[model samples]
Target chain A: MELFTYENIIGIAAGICTSIAMLPQLIKVIKTKETADLSVTMIGVLIVGVSLWVYYGFLQNEVPIILSNSFSVVVNLTLLICWFLFRKKS
Target chain B: MELFTYENIIGIAAGICTSIAMLPQLIKVIKTKETADLSVTMIGVLIVGVSLWVYYGFLQNEVPIILSNSFSVVVNLTLLICWFLFRKKS
Candidate 1:
Protein backbone atom coordinates (compact mmCIF):
# COMPACT_ATOMS: atom_id res chain seq x y z
CA MET A 1 0.00 0.00 0.00
CA GLU A 2 1.29 3.40 -0.89
CA LEU A 3 1.85 5.62 2.07
CA PHE A 4 -0.18 8.84 2.18
CA THR A 5 2.58 11.37 2.11
CA TYR A 6 2.04 14.56 4.05
CA GLU A 7 2.08 16.69 0.89
CA ASN A 8 -0.69 14.70 -0.74
CA ILE A 9 -2.79 14.89 2.37
CA ILE A 10 -2.44 18.66 2.61
CA GLY A 11 -3.21 19.20 -1.04
CA ILE A 12 -6.30 17.04 -0.83
CA ALA A 13 -7.48 18.85 2.27
CA ALA A 14 -7.04 22.24 0.67
CA GLY A 15 -8.94 21.17 -2.39
CA ILE A 16 -11.80 19.74 -0.35
CA CYS A 17 -12.16 22.78 1.86
CA THR A 18 -12.10 25.33 -0.91
CA SER A 19 -14.50 23.33 -3.03
CA ILE A 20 -16.93 22.92 -0.16
CA ALA A 21 -16.80 26.63 0.60
CA MET A 22 -18.55 27.32 -2.68
CA LEU A 23 -21.46 25.11 -1.70
CA PRO A 24 -23.32 27.50 0.58
CA GLN A 25 -23.32 30.32 -1.92
CA LEU A 26 -24.24 28.02 -4.75
CA ILE A 27 -27.13 26.62 -2.79
CA LYS A 28 -28.30 30.03 -1.68
CA VAL A 29 -28.21 31.44 -5.19
CA ILE A 30 -30.05 28.45 -6.60
CA LYS A 31 -32.79 28.23 -4.02
CA THR A 32 -33.48 31.88 -3.37
CA LYS A 33 -33.07 33.04 -6.96
CA GLU A 34 -32.07 36.28 -5.35
CA THR A 35 -28.67 37.88 -5.18
CA ALA A 36 -29.71 41.35 -4.21
CA ASP A 37 -27.75 41.03 -1.03
CA LEU A 38 -24.61 39.87 -2.82
CA SER A 39 -22.09 42.51 -3.70
CA VAL A 40 -20.92 43.17 -7.25
CA THR A 41 -17.65 44.56 -6.05
CA MET A 42 -16.90 41.42 -4.11
CA ILE A 43 -17.65 39.20 -7.08
CA GLY A 44 -15.46 41.31 -9.30
CA VAL A 45 -12.64 41.08 -6.84
CA LEU A 46 -13.06 37.33 -6.70
CA ILE A 47 -12.90 37.06 -10.47
CA VAL A 48 -9.61 38.85 -10.47
CA GLY A 49 -8.31 36.60 -7.71
CA VAL A 50 -9.34 33.36 -9.45
CA SER A 51 -7.87 34.58 -12.68
CA LEU A 52 -4.58 35.00 -10.90
CA TRP A 53 -4.84 31.50 -9.48
CA VAL A 54 -5.36 30.07 -12.94
CA TYR A 55 -2.30 31.93 -14.14
CA TYR A 56 -0.35 30.70 -11.14
CA GLY A 57 -1.44 27.13 -11.76
CA PHE A 58 -0.28 27.40 -15.35
CA LEU A 59 3.09 28.71 -14.29
CA GLN A 60 3.57 26.00 -11.68
CA ASN A 61 2.55 23.19 -14.06
CA GLU A 62 0.40 21.81 -11.26
CA VAL A 63 -2.38 20.00 -13.06
CA PRO A 64 -4.52 19.34 -10.03
CA ILE A 65 -4.30 22.88 -8.79
CA ILE A 66 -4.96 24.33 -12.20
CA LEU A 67 -7.91 22.05 -12.86
CA SER A 68 -9.56 22.60 -9.53
CA ASN A 69 -9.20 26.36 -9.65
CA SER A 70 -10.31 26.53 -13.26
CA PHE A 71 -13.51 24.81 -12.32
CA SER A 72 -13.88 27.25 -9.47
CA VAL A 73 -13.49 30.19 -11.80
CA VAL A 74 -16.28 28.88 -13.95
CA VAL A 75 -18.58 28.39 -10.99
CA ASN A 76 -17.87 31.84 -9.60
CA LEU A 77 -18.35 33.53 -12.92
CA THR A 78 -21.66 31.80 -13.32
CA LEU A 79 -22.83 33.00 -9.96
CA LEU A 80 -21.83 36.52 -10.78
CA ILE A 81 -23.74 36.35 -14.00
CA CYS A 82 -26.77 35.05 -12.18
CA TRP A 83 -26.60 37.90 -9.76
CA PHE A 84 -26.42 40.41 -12.54
CA LEU A 85 -29.36 38.95 -14.41
CA PHE A 86 -31.45 38.76 -11.29
CA ARG A 87 -30.65 42.31 -10.36
CA LYS A 88 -31.43 43.63 -13.82
CA LYS A 89 -34.79 41.92 -13.79
CA SER A 90 -35.72 43.24 -10.40
CA MET B 1 15.40 40.26 -8.33
CA GLU B 2 13.80 36.88 -7.62
CA LEU B 3 13.04 35.00 -10.77
CA PHE B 4 9.38 34.15 -11.17
CA THR B 5 9.64 30.49 -11.80
CA TYR B 6 6.70 28.63 -13.25
CA GLU B 7 5.93 27.02 -9.90
CA ASN B 8 6.09 30.27 -7.99
CA ILE B 9 3.90 32.04 -10.49
CA ILE B 10 1.31 29.31 -10.35
CA GLY B 11 1.38 29.28 -6.60
CA ILE B 12 0.88 33.01 -6.46
CA ALA B 13 -1.95 32.91 -8.95
CA ALA B 14 -3.76 30.14 -7.12
CA GLY B 15 -3.38 31.99 -3.88
CA ILE B 16 -4.79 35.16 -5.38
CA CYS B 17 -7.71 33.48 -7.05
CA THR B 18 -8.81 31.32 -4.14
CA SER B 19 -8.43 34.19 -1.75
CA ILE B 20 -10.43 36.50 -3.96
CA ALA B 21 -13.19 33.98 -4.50
CA MET B 22 -14.36 34.62 -0.98
CA LEU B 23 -15.08 38.26 -1.70
CA PRO B 24 -18.56 38.08 -3.16
CA GLN B 25 -20.08 36.02 -0.39
CA LEU B 26 -18.25 37.96 2.23
CA ILE B 27 -19.49 41.23 0.86
CA LYS B 28 -23.00 39.93 0.47
CA VAL B 29 -23.21 38.69 4.01
CA ILE B 30 -21.71 41.85 5.36
CA LYS B 31 -23.70 44.35 3.34
CA THR B 32 -27.12 42.80 3.52
CA LYS B 33 -26.74 41.17 6.88
CA GLU B 34 -28.74 38.34 5.40
CA THR B 35 -27.74 34.79 4.68
CA ALA B 36 -31.12 33.59 3.63
CA ASP B 37 -29.83 32.62 0.22
CA LEU B 38 -26.76 30.79 1.47
CA SER B 39 -26.65 27.02 1.93
CA VAL B 40 -25.63 25.34 5.15
CA THR B 41 -24.65 22.13 3.35
CA MET B 42 -22.34 23.97 1.00
CA ILE B 43 -20.60 25.79 3.81
CA GLY B 44 -20.20 22.48 5.63
CA VAL B 45 -18.63 20.91 2.59
CA LEU B 46 -16.22 23.80 2.12
CA ILE B 47 -15.14 23.64 5.74
CA VAL B 48 -14.28 19.98 5.22
CA GLY B 49 -12.40 20.76 2.03
CA VAL B 50 -10.32 23.56 3.52
CA SER B 51 -9.58 21.41 6.54
CA LEU B 52 -8.22 18.76 4.17
CA TRP B 53 -6.06 21.37 2.49
CA VAL B 54 -4.66 22.46 5.84
CA TYR B 55 -3.89 18.86 6.63
CA TYR B 56 -2.29 18.43 3.23
CA GLY B 57 -0.11 21.44 3.83
CA PHE B 58 0.98 20.10 7.19
CA LEU B 59 1.78 16.72 5.66
CA GLN B 60 3.79 18.36 2.90
CA ASN B 61 5.53 20.79 5.22
CA GLU B 62 4.69 23.59 2.81
CA VAL B 63 4.54 26.77 4.80
CA PRO B 64 3.11 28.85 1.98
CA ILE B 65 0.31 26.42 1.29
CA ILE B 66 -0.49 25.94 4.94
CA LEU B 67 -0.41 29.61 5.73
CA SER B 68 -2.57 30.60 2.80
CA ASN B 69 -5.15 27.92 3.46
CA SER B 70 -5.17 28.64 7.16
CA PHE B 71 -6.13 32.22 6.41
CA SER B 72 -8.74 30.92 4.04
CA VAL B 73 -10.16 28.72 6.77
CA VAL B 74 -10.56 31.70 9.04
CA VAL B 75 -12.29 33.75 6.38
CA ASN B 76 -14.60 30.94 5.39
CA LEU B 77 -15.46 30.08 8.96
CA THR B 78 -16.32 33.72 9.56
CA LEU B 79 -18.70 33.74 6.62
CA LEU B 80 -20.34 30.59 7.86
CA ILE B 81 -20.77 32.09 11.29
CA CYS B 82 -22.24 35.21 9.81
CA TRP B 83 -24.70 33.16 7.88
CA PHE B 84 -25.79 31.34 11.03
CA LEU B 85 -26.15 34.52 12.95
CA PHE B 86 -28.11 36.19 10.17
CA ARG B 87 -30.36 33.20 9.83
CA LYS B 88 -31.06 33.05 13.51
CA LYS B 89 -31.89 36.71 13.63
CA SER B 90 -34.05 36.66 10.52
Candidate 2:
Protein backbone atom coordinates (compact mmCIF):
# COMPACT_ATOMS: atom_id res chain seq x y z
CA MET A 1 0.00 0.00 0.00
CA GLU A 2 1.28 3.44 -0.82
CA LEU A 3 2.01 5.80 2.09
CA PHE A 4 0.12 8.77 0.63
CA THR A 5 -2.29 8.85 -2.25
CA TYR A 6 -3.61 11.78 -4.23
CA GLU A 7 -6.89 11.41 -2.36
CA ASN A 8 -5.14 11.79 0.96
CA ILE A 9 -3.30 14.86 -0.25
CA ILE A 10 -6.53 16.45 -1.43
CA GLY A 11 -8.24 15.53 1.81
CA ILE A 12 -5.45 17.17 3.75
CA ALA A 13 -5.75 20.23 1.59
CA ALA A 14 -9.49 20.29 2.16
CA GLY A 15 -8.99 19.96 5.86
CA ILE A 16 -6.54 22.82 6.02
CA CYS A 17 -8.75 25.06 3.92
CA THR A 18 -11.91 24.34 5.89
CA SER A 19 -10.25 24.51 9.26
CA ILE A 20 -9.42 28.20 8.87
CA ALA A 21 -12.08 29.29 6.42
CA MET A 22 -13.96 31.29 9.03
CA LEU A 23 -10.97 33.24 10.34
CA PRO A 24 -11.24 36.04 7.86
CA GLN A 25 -14.88 36.56 8.70
CA LEU A 26 -14.10 36.60 12.38
CA ILE A 27 -11.37 39.16 11.86
CA LYS A 28 -13.59 41.28 9.69
CA VAL A 29 -16.42 41.15 12.18
CA ILE A 30 -14.14 42.18 14.98
CA LYS A 31 -12.48 44.92 13.01
CA THR A 32 -15.58 46.47 11.53
CA LYS A 33 -18.14 45.67 14.23
CA GLU A 34 -20.49 44.52 11.51
CA THR A 35 -22.65 41.44 11.84
CA ALA A 36 -26.12 42.70 11.06
CA ASP A 37 -25.83 41.55 7.50
CA LEU A 38 -24.51 38.12 8.44
CA SER A 39 -26.92 35.26 8.64
CA VAL A 40 -27.59 33.87 12.08
CA THR A 41 -29.01 30.68 10.68
CA MET A 42 -25.82 29.94 8.78
CA ILE A 43 -23.69 30.33 11.88
CA GLY A 44 -26.04 28.25 13.93
CA VAL A 45 -26.09 25.44 11.42
CA LEU A 46 -22.33 25.53 11.02
CA ILE A 47 -21.86 25.17 14.75
CA VAL A 48 -24.10 22.16 14.76
CA GLY A 49 -22.30 20.64 11.79
CA VAL A 50 -18.80 21.10 13.17
CA SER A 51 -19.92 19.80 16.55
CA LEU A 52 -21.20 16.64 14.93
CA TRP A 53 -17.97 16.29 12.97
CA VAL A 54 -16.08 16.47 16.22
CA TYR A 55 -18.30 13.85 17.74
CA TYR A 56 -17.89 11.67 14.69
CA GLY A 57 -14.14 12.07 14.90
CA PHE A 58 -14.14 11.04 18.54
CA LEU A 59 -16.23 7.97 17.74
CA GLN A 60 -13.98 7.06 14.85
CA ASN A 61 -10.78 7.75 16.76
CA GLU A 62 -9.60 10.25 14.20
CA VAL A 63 -7.41 12.82 15.89
CA PRO A 64 -7.12 15.21 12.98
CA ILE A 65 -10.83 15.36 12.31
CA ILE A 66 -11.52 15.94 15.96
CA LEU A 67 -8.97 18.75 16.22
CA SER A 68 -10.03 20.42 13.02
CA ASN A 69 -13.73 20.31 13.79
CA SER A 70 -13.10 21.42 17.33
CA PHE A 71 -11.25 24.47 16.11
CA SER A 72 -13.92 25.20 13.53
CA VAL A 73 -16.67 24.86 16.09
CA VAL A 74 -14.96 27.29 18.42
CA VAL A 75 -14.29 29.81 15.73
CA ASN A 76 -17.81 29.57 14.39
CA LEU A 77 -19.28 29.90 17.86
CA THR A 78 -17.15 32.93 18.45
CA LEU A 79 -18.49 34.41 15.27
CA LEU A 80 -22.02 33.73 16.41
CA ILE A 81 -21.42 35.44 19.69
CA CYS A 82 -19.81 38.33 17.90
CA TRP A 83 -22.88 38.64 15.76
CA PHE A 84 -25.02 39.00 18.81
CA LEU A 85 -22.67 41.42 20.50
CA PHE A 86 -21.75 43.61 17.59
CA ARG A 87 -24.92 43.87 15.58
CA LYS A 88 -26.15 47.44 15.33
CA LYS A 89 -29.23 48.31 17.34
CA SER A 90 -31.27 50.19 14.81
CA MET B 1 -19.73 -5.78 12.26
CA GLU B 2 -22.90 -3.78 12.31
CA LEU B 3 -23.67 -1.83 9.19
CA PHE B 4 -24.42 1.42 11.00
CA THR B 5 -22.60 2.67 14.07
CA TYR B 6 -22.75 5.75 16.24
CA GLU B 7 -19.80 7.17 14.38
CA ASN B 8 -21.50 6.68 11.05
CA ILE B 9 -24.69 8.26 12.30
CA ILE B 10 -22.86 11.30 13.57
CA GLY B 11 -20.92 11.56 10.37
CA ILE B 12 -24.11 11.51 8.35
CA ALA B 13 -25.64 14.13 10.56
CA ALA B 14 -22.55 16.25 10.21
CA GLY B 15 -22.62 15.88 6.48
CA ILE B 16 -26.23 16.92 6.27
CA CYS B 17 -25.67 19.89 8.51
CA THR B 18 -22.64 21.18 6.68
CA SER B 19 -24.20 20.56 3.31
CA ILE B 20 -27.01 23.03 3.85
CA ALA B 21 -25.37 25.40 6.29
CA MET B 22 -24.72 27.97 3.61
CA LEU B 23 -28.23 27.96 2.26
CA PRO B 24 -29.51 30.44 4.75
CA GLN B 25 -26.72 32.83 3.95
CA LEU B 26 -27.37 32.56 0.27
CA ILE B 27 -31.03 33.29 0.78
CA LYS B 28 -30.22 36.22 3.00
CA VAL B 29 -27.83 37.70 0.46
CA ILE B 30 -30.35 37.32 -2.29
CA LYS B 31 -33.19 38.77 -0.27
CA THR B 32 -31.49 41.66 1.47
CA LYS B 33 -28.84 42.44 -1.10
CA GLU B 34 -26.26 42.74 1.63
CA THR B 35 -22.71 41.55 1.23
CA ALA B 36 -20.64 44.50 2.23
CA ASP B 37 -20.31 43.27 5.80
CA LEU B 38 -19.17 39.88 4.60
CA SER B 39 -15.48 39.13 4.12
CA VAL B 40 -14.27 38.39 0.62
CA THR B 41 -11.20 36.65 1.99
CA MET B 42 -13.36 34.22 3.88
CA ILE B 43 -15.43 33.48 0.80
CA GLY B 44 -12.30 33.09 -1.32
CA VAL B 45 -10.73 30.69 1.15
CA LEU B 46 -13.98 28.76 1.45
CA ILE B 47 -14.17 28.40 -2.33
CA VAL B 48 -10.68 26.97 -2.32
CA GLY B 49 -11.55 24.73 0.58
CA VAL B 50 -14.77 23.35 -0.86
CA SER B 51 -13.17 22.89 -4.25
CA LEU B 52 -10.47 20.78 -2.62
CA TRP B 53 -13.20 18.85 -0.86
CA VAL B 54 -14.84 18.17 -4.20
CA TYR B 55 -11.50 17.01 -5.61
CA TYR B 56 -10.90 14.93 -2.54
CA GLY B 57 -14.35 13.46 -2.89
CA PHE B 58 -13.68 12.52 -6.49
CA LEU B 59 -10.44 10.87 -5.48
CA GLN B 60 -12.08 9.00 -2.59
CA ASN B 61 -15.31 8.26 -4.39
CA GLU B 62 -17.28 10.15 -1.76
CA VAL B 63 -20.44 11.20 -3.48
CA PRO B 64 -21.83 13.05 -0.49
CA ILE B 65 -18.73 15.13 0.02
CA ILE B 66 -18.60 16.00 -3.63
CA LEU B 67 -22.24 17.00 -3.78
CA SER B 68 -22.14 18.99 -0.58
CA ASN B 69 -18.98 20.87 -1.39
CA SER B 70 -20.17 21.55 -4.88
CA PHE B 71 -23.31 23.20 -3.54
CA SER B 72 -21.29 25.17 -1.04
CA VAL B 73 -18.86 26.30 -3.69
CA VAL B 74 -21.64 27.61 -5.88
CA VAL B 75 -23.32 29.44 -3.04
CA ASN B 76 -20.08 30.97 -1.82
CA LEU B 77 -19.20 32.04 -5.34
CA THR B 78 -22.60 33.63 -5.70
CA LEU B 79 -22.06 35.39 -2.41
CA LEU B 80 -18.70 36.62 -3.63
CA ILE B 81 -20.21 37.93 -6.80
CA CYS B 82 -22.97 39.53 -4.76
CA TRP B 83 -20.25 41.19 -2.73
CA PHE B 84 -18.89 42.69 -5.90
CA LEU B 85 -22.25 43.66 -7.31
CA PHE B 86 -24.27 44.80 -4.30
CA ARG B 87 -21.68 46.39 -2.08
CA LYS B 88 -22.75 49.89 -1.14
CA LYS B 89 -21.72 52.47 -3.72
CA SER B 90 -20.12 54.67 -1.10
lDDT of 2 by residue, B3-85 (tens): 35665567667878987776777887788897765778878888998898788666655454566678788888999888888
List where candidate 1 sits over 4 angstroms from the true fold.
Answer: A1-17, A27-32, B1-17, B20-38, B79-90
How does candidate 2 fare on TM-score?
Answer: 0.71
In the range B1-90, model 1's lDDT, one tens digit per residue, is 243655555555666665765666687688889887666777777777777766765654445456667877787788888987788766
**Root-mean-square deviation of every model:** 4.3, 4.0
CAPRI docking class of candidate 1: medium
Which candidate number maximizes DockQ? 2
Model 1's DockQ? Answer: 0.54
Per-residue CA lDDT of model 2 for A1-90, tens digit only, reads: 342566666666777887777677788778888887677887888899989878866665545456668888889889888888877651
Write the residue-wise lDDT of candidate 1 on A1-90 in tens digits: 233455544554566566656666767777878887677777777777676766665554444455667777887888888887788655
lDDT of each: 0.67, 0.75
* Model 2: CAPRI class: medium
| The TM-score obtained for chain B of candidate 2 when compared with the true chain B | 0.78
After TM-score superposition, what is the CA distance of residue B43 in candidate 2 from its true location, in Å?
2.1
